[model samples]
Target: MKPRTLVIGDIHGGLKALKQVLARAEVTAQDTLIFLGDYVDGWGESAQVIQFLIELEQKQTCIFIKGNHDLWCEDWLKEHILDKTWLFHGGQSTLKSYESLNDAEHALHLNFFERMRLYYVDEQNRLFVHAGFTSMHGPAQEFHQSNFKWDRTLWEMALTMHKHITKDSKLYPKRLLLFKEIFIGHTPTLNYDVTIPMNGCNVWNVDTGAAFTGSLTIMDIDTKEFWQSDTLVSLYPNEKGRNR
Candidate 1:
């Protein structure tokens, strides 16, 4: 049997938490790991988390989706100047992570960033994006690239729906109907007072708030079986994550 596809949420540089979730998920060489982005910022090991992910690719199939923060990091890498807004939102930690890397390592990490996708849709029509998708006209590619990593309307609309029905349902975003399932991780589930993966209108939000007080989540796309780490702060006991 083929290994399952595990879609993970925002990590925010919580290396320990990332490791814990992966171990709990029982990921194997046959498994496909799809990271929903925000791999850096917030915690002390942002740099290490990226390096760990790079190494993991050598053994497992890993798909990375670019997030808003990841885009900020890209800008910083090219300009070598920190944007104030980015700095305000835990960007300092990402910079700190890169400061420890040597020249060659920096290039490799940059390559990883450059290779990130705005969104990934598998053969099964399972859509994976860092944030929510916008527009009711067509598929993810029809919208702007930023929409893939920054829009929250998809999840927000799902939240307002009374149930999770898919066929002929007017309560949810019509664009979502294009896929069998849509997986995203930008809007943390913690805001809903939940720390685990959540489902609304056939959309699954796996970001259990690893950047805040919640844990990180990794869910099997088909079975919906999932795993979560302890509160992110617990993973990095010594550091205050984004002071959140």
Candidate 2:
């Protein structure tokens, strides 16, 4: 089989959904998996999800990008401090997931989180980030690093300018011109009533809201072919996930 580059959406601790999508996509060791992060803080298996990824990289090439939720979880793992907002937004579930982990295991997961990249620029000039960056100079020159994990302005601009303005137009966003293509996942496509990956201009959003009622997604970046898992709400019926 040919080596392929696959971009995955947010897992949000839905290990079952993550597994399903990988299987559906027929992922292999020959493929390079680029995960968009948020691997924890939604469902009941936050620790398990991180554990699985740690083990996965041993056999395959994987690029992990850190998300806003993952940052919060890393803080708790390193300092054992809980943020009230994080707790309300699925941090409690993440805490419960780590109860069974020993100190050694916690240390390993913390190391994994710390190693994640905020953004990655491929040789082909494709940018993969958990969310979006604010700098017109591109992510490398971004003044606010948090924007890499939390900005929505880039995606919003893409949507607003998509089809309305051409690349040659003076009104075209300079940030959008920075890359051949941009792939992101912090903002769920389900928010716009879509359950599949969304494309606006050169930006592709793969987050299908697995943290709530949608499915997890994995896309072949070159082909734009994708696969999805069943709705996360149905997969773990008893848990509210991030729906609460």
Against the hidden reference, what TM-scores do the models get? 0.94, 0.99
Q: Rate the local accuracy (lDDT) of all candidates.
A: 0.86, 0.94
Clashing pairs in 2: none
Cα-lDDT of candidate 1:
0.86
Best-matching candidate per TM-score: 2
Clashing pairs in 1: none
How much is the lDDT of residue 213 in candidate 1? Answer: 93
Worst 10 residues of 2 by lDDT: 235-244
lDDT of 1 by residue, 1-244 (tens): 5679899899999999999988887788999999999998899888899899999999989999999998898787766768898898899988888887898988888889999998888998888988876667644445577888788888887777737554675654677678888899999888889978888877899999999899998898989989899998887888878755
Which regions of candidate 2 fall more than 4 Å away from where they truly are?
none
Candidate 2 C-alpha lDDT tens digits along 22-108: 899999999999999899989999999999999999999999999999999999999987999889988999999999999999999
RMSD of 1: 1.7
